[model samples]
Target: QREFTQKKTFTSWINSILAKHTPPYVVSDLYTDIQQGHLLLDLLEVLSGQHLPREKGFNTFQCRSNIENALTFLKSRSLKLINIHVADIIEGKPSIVLGLIWTIIFHFHIEELARTLACTYNQPSLDCSSAVDSSPKASRSAKKSARIKERWKMSATKALLLWAKEQCSLHGSVNVTDFKSSWRSGLAFLAIIQTLRPGLVDLEKAKARSNKENLKEAFRIAELELNIPRLLEPEDVDIVNPDEKSIMTYVAQFLQYSKNLPESEEDLQEKVREAMGWLAAQEKKLAKLLVETENETYYQKCKEMMSFMETFNQEKTPFLPVLSSKRGEAELSEGQQQMREEWDKVVSQINEWKAKLDQMLPSPLDSIEAWLQEVERLQAEDLPDLQDPFKAMSVFREIIVIFKGLMDCFDSHLDTLQSFKNEDEKNMPLVLPEKLEEMKRRLFSNIRSTNPSTFLEYHYGLCSAIANEVKLKLNICDVKYGAKESVESLLENW
Candidate 1:
């Protein structure tokens, strides 16, 4: 009972192992067949165990013996079984086949496996027979066994080589140096598997020579393909008006291409150097052009400012009343007091104008001029790094907006001044005449109550006094001219 239980347990264990290790796409029949082939299972267990830690009680020599015994036993099987099953060994569980081959190489140090592998799938074996040792039947059986062994070895080795080639190809595209290293290691491993060190050395030399030639061809192709002159065309560079960035992009691309080329190519290196020099010269030219453009822009702004000033000077007129103290006596009569109060109101308006003018000065235009002067100085000294053209343009644009606003203020001020001037001119002449007529009517009505001559003399004295007051107040015209002069002077200074 115990023996049967152990057998059942072992069967279950092998089944699970095969299921876990075999790819899912492999049919269940393949696993079952491999499981029933006890010799192959035993060999797989031993070979797989070799990769485990020593603590797992792995025996290297026992593993080698197991693999040899498995191959030998497989040789004794029918030719149909050997061909079908051994091919399935490679097709169904290729990783296991590779592991077993690597294990054989590691333990036995044989080279036949790697050699047979390279040509197995495509090449046919010679049917040469060795001299018989005994009866015809025995000799024929021995020859058949040898043929089967050779066939199984070739199939297994071919599977392993195919797997390695696939892996190496994957690594090659990602990193050529790593691919080369893997290739060398694979060659070394294959040499040990086939036990053919001299053959591997020759193969390695041939491969290295071929790789060098291919690398030279690839470099030559790259040199011809990266046409730097066509890439750095003038039309392409003109995408950004001042094309510094475009030129630099072309330079960067050229440098990147040059970095990949072999350093031994002196002609390519010389071309790269010349291209870099040309790009450097182009950069300098662009920088100079930028500076000249900025200078021209500033000059244009200055012209605009000067032209605006000329128009402003032509359009500017004094808006304030020119009041003379002599126009009104220090002791003002009632009507004269009203005139004086109005004059004070005009002065207040002039004060307001002065305040606004004060706020507008060191104006945006003046600020732009100061900024331009600094930029010009930097440019003249060849210190282009110190200038910011964008900032300068922004300031210039703001000054233009501010000048427009100031012109609007000037227009409003002129309108207000003209309205006030019209009011004074329309009302001033009637003020004195109306007051004198009222005084004449009052004096004539009281003539019967006093001496006629005395009353007439009093009326004349009053008339003279009124005339003097009117004369004094009329000097506001002079005050108007004085205020206008002040405004003109302020504008001139501005």
Candidate 2:
């Protein structure tokens, strides 16, 4: 039953993405449709907007090759595919095909859903920008917890659960504790539709209906009115236990499509007010993170703010009104024009903040140069005095440790730069080979062993040699003094 639900839901999901292609392709049966693998490639292309190379022939080898190419692409995305293989998919194995599709859905849709949902959290303002209680304790507590509150992080599952519970709260007995049994009755679905459109779902009628009847009605209304893809069938969800993942995948579309729903004038006005409030809050948050400091905390906050800006750009930008239309007419209301100007300013601020962060965050080359400067300082500094061997040894050890620490920092920074390249090449820092070579040459010229240990050993040897010379000189002076004393005593006796 679970597999049946998954097959239906995943097939609809793929078909929905594929329908957006230039020439729509519908998959009647996911297992057979994806057996040849070209459709699978098309599905991936639509979902990811990436062109995947595929074998065009219908022969067994070509088919297998196409499947292999798709699998390779999935693996390159760092997706964990357990026991999934091209042969299994090629043979039209239902379980393998279902598993592959689920993996795709989890990665492309579920993971992105998690990230998108993060933007919706009403995090406390970074400062006391909003009204606060007049009590001293209240103000102090709010200030004390502001930093922690600003770092808003919530799991996708919990976020979705909260959203569902909120949507169904007014309906009868439609408790959505988890994605599984909570939705098995299908009242939750009706309640969501009813909340979105007041008269769309007759909640009273739905409650009196059988589970299958209610599920079917909800799916029909959603597909017809909302244009949401009917990912699950009545039987798929009306069973004793519906598939949790399938329900989640289906429910998420409601949130995705909610924005496109036609709003009344009142609702649109409310949206504008809400958007303005949200922008004000975000601006306050940005201001807090925009502190003038070179500390590690400041750097981390910059990183977090940059990430938040990315989400804002993707999700919130659509709601921001434009002052002028593409036809060069001022189409927005006065309030909207103000909103647009504010939005533009916020966008400009984001760009400026991002540039500041990029410059402040040490690039790989910058880290290397900084590391070389430190090592050079160590090289030029005078070696510790051999008179106190213990202190000298301690100083040498400290310098060596610093060298090792710098190298470790450089490696970590380089890895971070490489990751930035992988994630987005445009954001990657430029690395020039000539400059790197020059730094490398300067570093090695000052020491041998090609390691920090070489610096340690050289200083250690120098300190030992100087200590031995000092000891020898002291012994010789003692001998000479004793001889002089003996001669003086003999002259007195004569």
- For each candidate, the alpha-carbon lDDT, in order, equals 0.31, 0.62
How many clashes (backbone N, Cα, C below 3 Å) per candidate? 11, 0
Question: Which runs of model 2 end up more than 4 angstroms from their true locations?
Answer: 122-154, 170-173, 262-267, 270-494
**Could you estimate the TM-score for every candidate?**
0.13, 0.48
Q: Give the alpha carbon lDDT tens digit for every residue of 221-325 in model 2.
A: 999998888988887877656798899899888767654555465665666677777778778767776753345443355556645654554344334222111
Can you write out model 1's per-residue Cα lDDT over 428-469, one digit (the tens) per residue? 321223222322322222111211222233344456556665
Against the true structure, candidate 1 reaches a TM-score of 0.13
Best by lDDT: 2
Q: Model 1 off-target regions past 4 Å?
A: 1-72, 78-159, 170-494
Clashing pairs in 2: none
